[model samples]
Target: MFPQSTQSPPTSLQVHPVPFLANTQDADELGAGSVEVPSWQIPDLVVECPKRPGARIHKGTSLILPEAGGDLLACIVRSLPVLLQIRPRWILGYSMAVDGVSLRTMYRQLEHSGPCVMIVEDSSNCIFGAFLSEGLRPVSQCYGTHECFVFRTPRLAGAWRTEVYGRSVAPTSPSQIEGASVPKPESEGASPPAGFSGQKAKYFEALRKAQAPSSSASVFCNHMGIVVGTDGPALFIDQDLLRGASWPSVGFGSPSLCTAGTDFVVRNIEARQNRFGIGAPNANERPVK
Candidate 1:
């Protein structure tokens, strides 16, 4: 089983933090570049899937990517523009745990930027993910606010779901409950953060209240626990709203990527810069601009 992030991004799910697994052979070359940042790599792993897989279930199970998605994972990596500034560490499966040493290393590298992508497969066989742009932290601290994007592939829309939460249309108190949705902050007469407008403002406002120290029901108040009416630290992706003509055919858990040949199943993910290319990963080159 994989590990879950001890920390999480605001309103998004906890992620698995894959620390930079340094190869002794490449130790000397790691010193190059202006930042001296260690390139994040996905070490290989052996995975086991049930005779019949279930949706959103990761207990003792590893996921397999579909054959059509040969380039899908690559496409997903390339789709993120922020990868240019900060590196990415993928967390496979929500329930997986990461070691303290690795988490510390990731923190030193990610300090204030980058993303941790959460990958999981649902009962429907569709892949789902949460990209926490701000990265992870100790669950005790208030998870910082950054771009949170959710996506699912092989759907009608090609564009991934960027934002999902909205402020209640009416003025309500911060403490009031409105169905299964997270409560609103405008009820407390608070203004949205600077530079946030439209749905983005509304979304963050509600998130702020849910995580506020004053709120007894704060979702993030307790480290690594889920609250009712509050989606676990996950970034919500509305399948209906995210659909657009420009969306891609990307998804989580592909059978092809999960298997090497007929006999063996994939043990771990191999991070790639070029999804279409064959061979070792390009260690020196940053693929996206």
Candidate 2:
């Protein structure tokens, strides 16, 4: 989970521009008094990199790949939308770690050698982190092929307000809590009583009925799924169901062949009822079509 806080920036990385936006707010109502951003008040879980202890992969931290290898840049690019949604004051940028990726070598080549310069500019779409600099000059003439990338996040304003504004006049059920995933105990040790064996005279007779899901398809919140395969003519599927359903639920873009498996989420969609031909990841679900 990505953590959110205005406490301070990461020390190892450098965040420039000292962002104009403050607090998490949608494009709209973000700067009006104070914007309401998505759930960024809670910080991401602290990743304990047992292999790389020195590296603290915390939320809002910059991560530099040794080089532009695999899908590192693409993974980083996805965060831009999240940042715009969160609208944090700043974002830290990291230097690619050596001996980690081939991308690190690319950075070195660009930083030192060559006659690289800006040749064209697609100014129509103002994307985030899209900057072309020569000796730190972000002008149109300062960009070129493979020399730079559009990295600046597009700035949106007034995009989150709804047509219906005022609070509901009628009371609503306390069913859904907006930002609470942690559950509370109903009573002291409110779980099943602990014991492997029972005393004599305790008549043990239990009967339970077994049945399949009420429907051919079942939808679960935060349900896990696996990539059965690409959606092309020649598709491939995975045996391991996916863990991050949200990542794919939006839509599967140009999936890359990388160290990490490609993921796609089908909403209100199940592996069974295989008429759609979607494959299930395990014995519980159906096979790929």
Candidate 3:
């Protein structure tokens, strides 16, 4: 009211009030009009780490896996499924040094349902472990999904060499040979029939297919300990939890985990579980392999 301007207000200088804070409806309208950008398309995606440069992502101290340098831990995390790639707070569920060397005790400590990583450091200093789909328990029948896998980390100077062995996909089943024609055997020391060699190859191929282990034999546990394979266990931890064995297995198709030999003396064993919920399956529900 100080001075009434005779000139018309500038048409180009219209004053539009701007909101300092958007209401829920305004936010919703903005979001409805926006398009989500793909993560890969974004440049310089920054991953915030702890303030300390040399600090570890896993909070607690670990024996087999070093806390300061997370090379081995990174390998294990990379091997995990996509759903489990979330930043994890690894809680030590069981440690042989702290919890005592008892398989039953280990089972008790890991009774709750969730995926866990079992690490074993043998006498030769070779590090190996298995990613269990569910908590460790004594089950009469083989129980576990194909998510179970074995891994071995060989000690190398200034580097971590990790070998991961996944479940085997058996070859296609051989055709029905029940009523198939069989090649007649020739006289001893005489040349075989014209098509005998071909038939022999087919016979051996069929035999090998029959011997391959099924996917259902993923994991088995009893009163003794845990077994990874039915035919020849890729990894086995005894009741004492002091000794273990590894061998070439048709189940996981893994080579011997222990560098020393098939049997290995457990130096230190550590079982770690994610603190955050992983949406693991219930005990009653057997996941299809």
Model 1: per-residue lDDT, tens digit, 217-237?
222213222111122222222
Candidate numbers sorted by lDDT from highest down:
3, 1, 2
Clashes of 1: 29
Query: Which 10 successive residues of model 3 have the least lDDT summed?
Result: 13-22
The RMSD of every model to the true structure, in order and in angstroms, is 18.1, 24.3, 20.8
Instruction: Supply the TM-score for candidate 3.
Output: 0.59
Candidate 3 residue pairs in backbone clash: none
The per-residue C-alpha lDDT of model 1 at residue 135 equals 51
Model 2 / residue 247 / CA error / Å: 17
Q: Model-by-model lDDT, in order?
A: 0.28, 0.19, 0.53
Residue range with the least summed lDDT across 10 consecutive positions in model 2: 200-209
Runs of candidate 1 with Cα error greater than 4 angstroms are 1-75, 85-114, 154-223, 226-289
lDDT of 3 by residue, 208-243 (tens): 234434552366666666766544456777667777
In candidate 2, what are the lDDT values of residues 144-219, reduced to their tens digit?
2222222222212223211100111211222221011111223423321122113100111010001011110111
User: TM-score for each prediction?
Assistant: 0.33, 0.18, 0.59
State candidate 2's TM-score.
0.18
Using lDDT as the measure, which candidate wins? 3
